[model samples]
Target: MAELQMLLEEEIPAGRSALLDSFTNLERVAEYCESNYVQSPDKHRALEETKNYTTQSLASVAYLINTLANNVLQMLDIQASHTSLLLFL
Candidate 1:
């Protein structure tokens, strides 16, 4: 259980770093496209869709991570209380 918690704690930061890196890359790509060429209506629509999808996917992943962290903390809290009770008796 301690190992699992530690792994998750390590993973949460890595996940956040990945999300930031992805967004940074996306921004660079957008800036490059804007400076280099004119996009057609279809291409612009496609870009918008892609951006929306990426945003939603990132949100979902973040939500999942938050939920997992909360669950782990709750489990640890319960276990800690149980251990304390056992020690008390």
Candidate 2:
């Protein structure tokens, strides 16, 4: 839901806190999936809830991927800088 996303966006900070929050969000989705697969009082409501949870899960994954990409780029830049120095010798 929009509200859940808003809460997630506002409360969770970047870095370790964000990563832990993302894991918690993923756990919520997994728990929901486990419950919904059996039976539910309102199928539509459960489906909608699961959809929202899935969105949060995807956001977490995207954030992790972006973090990794940034680190990799930084490492490559450092390596390139060193290479240019080495070439001078």
TM-score of 1: 0.53
TM-score of each: 0.53, 0.63
What lDDT would candidate 1 get against the real structure?
0.66
After superposition, which runs of candidate 2 have C-alpha atoms over 4 Å from their true positions? 1-28
The 10-residue segment of model 1 with minimum total lDDT is: 32-41
Tens-digit lDDT track of model 1 for 1-89:
67556645775566666666766766766675564435555777666766776676678667766855775677677678879999999
lDDT for position 86 in model 2: 92
The per-residue C-alpha lDDT of model 1 at residue 22 equals 66
Ten residues in sequence with the least summed lDDT for candidate 2 = 4-13
Query: Which candidate tops lDDT?
Result: 2
